[model samples]
Target: MTEALEIRNLHVAIEDNEILKGVDLVVKQGEIHALMGPNGTGKSTLAKALLGHPDYEITAGEILFKGENIIEMDVDERARLGMFLAFQYPVAIPGVSVANFLRTAINAHRKAADPEDKGISIPDFRTLLKAKMDLLEMDHQFAGRYLNEGFSGGEKKRAEILQLATLEPAIAILDETDSGLDIDALRIVADGVNSLAGPDLGVLIITHYQRILNYIKPDFVHIMLDGRVAESGGPDLAEHLEEHGYNWLREKQSKATAG
Candidate 1:
């Protein structure tokens, strides 16, 4: 069965500040969805909460991944359940080669599933890593480099996609993957995401702008306002957003409510 990620009336807050009031969204495998909103509108908060971030407290509602409630699960458990988050600013982890880091992570997930199941062999890992790298058109030497060490902004984002490609999560939540990327870099990253998208993977791309959507082509476009989805439509909605901007939507929505 195709996996589904459903969020119902989610309210998340950190310390004394409430970021998400009541947001609802559902993403199904094989579908690409874009969640667009202005900055400080709880986009990243939703992403973190979905990942089961300890800092964010779930004040209300549920996050059901593949029909399982993951509100109380740990971050690793979320990953095992097929949830992945690509950060806007990925920190560099020095002294760890990209291949080694990924191998360790994959083995950890395998061990988590079955303590008795031995980890993937080095040869098998090399084969798998090469396949994923080739799919993303990455240089074979990339795997030998230290993770994010002396990498450009685009390289960091590409590395994140490589992780995504290797892990093959069911639901991929990208929190502003386009941030700090030039047009050329953005296209390459988008191409990587596009190549990986298919029947077994659901993508929720959260961003403040619509440029990425031009390349990614989301099946559904959602606009969030004040922590809730204010409107949803097809790809044209994103085009409309590009032409007019969120202020226009806010005014139109306000007038609709007043009327």
Candidate 2:
């Protein structure tokens, strides 16, 4: 399997305190990889670093997106390179309609794909937007609403997926996309992700619960401990983590150190 994202000994820090110590993760094309862990274990930090968040600094190591070093790339540059990150908390932008935001994003994507004067026309844009919205079961009225303003948690997540569908990114980092969602919303989001899954798209779903795994099974499950990925395996690993919790891992680590 060809690699979509490759991280080599990634060391990240925030305010001089290291959060990710020599972590490595790789996602191949068309694969769903889940990064599961307890709260505050650097899962979110890793996602932030991948998206080039300003506060998180990469103290060492390299992030290769399709063999290109992306650590130094700015957030917009990363997005332009077909990398999308759906935030855990979708921010609200008043006075910006969903329609306008989506159209602008789509235009940006088109511009990145073709740097020439060519771009997706307005009519073609609307058609594509409508088609994706329909796939996500989003209301036509949603187009007129301010971007995520007054939206429920479920609505925000659906909107995120809607953007994902429209952007068709090569690598999608869904950061805790399932948090605060009910069963119905979870199903809808999962369905949206599954429908869009293919050889061209690789997903890294950062989640804490196993419920979402039922809807979209990951090809690989990685457990992030204190500052690094401690374990990795297939889908069954998620089930194990759900049942036994992280205590066993803590115990094992302690014993290994003592011995």
Candidate 3:
């Protein structure tokens, strides 16, 4: 099984502060991996760095996508190469409608898939948008509303998944998508994500709580502490963290690094 995205001894820093220290992971096609950790453990930083966030400096290591080293690839270049990240806090663009935003992004993905193929036609774009919106349970009016201008927490999260469905990226990093969602909303978002699961999509789910794991059921679970991945296991790891919390894992990680 080929990995969709593989991080090799990745070390990321911001300004003078190091965040991710020698982290390594792999998300193979059709696999869902959960990244669970306490805050400031570099989970979000890893997602941002993979997306080539400007503030993040890759001080060391490599990110390989489909056997290509993307350490120096620009953010847009990475997106064009079938990488997507669902931000924990989505941005609100007051003037751009959700429909327009999605259409542009889908077209961009299409253009990248085939540089010679022209963008999606307006009628065709609308049809595709309606189909995805229906899958997310978004109202038709949502298509005309400004991007997250007044969306509730759940709405924003679902909107992010909508984009994911439309883009169909090979690898997706979902950053705390369950942060503000109620149980009902979390289920909906998880369903939408699950609908996209197959032989082509690999997901990296980053979260602090395991409640969402109960809904999404990751195949592998990783515990991140301090500034690196401390331990990894099957879904049972999530249950263990939920029961005992991070204190023990933090201590274990500290002792391991100390030795």
The Cα local distance difference test for each model comes to 0.93, 0.92, 0.91
Kindly provide the TM-score of model 2 when superposed on the true structure, using C-alpha atoms. 0.97
lDDT by residue (tens digit), candidate 2, 172-201: 999999999999999999999999999989
Q: Mind giving the per-residue lDDT tens digits that candidate 1 earns over 9-105?
A: 9999999688888888999999999999999888999999999989999999999999999998999999987899998888789999999999999
Per-prediction TM-score, please? 0.96, 0.97, 0.96
Between prediction 1 and prediction 3, the one with superior lDDT is 1
lDDT of 3 by residue, 26-58 (tens): 898899999999888899999999999999999
In candidate 2, stretches whose alpha carbon ends up further than 4 angstroms from where it belongs are 1-3
Model 3 — TM-score against the truth? 0.96
At residue 95, what lDDT does model 2 achieve? 100
Model 1 weakest lDDT span, ten residues long:
16-25
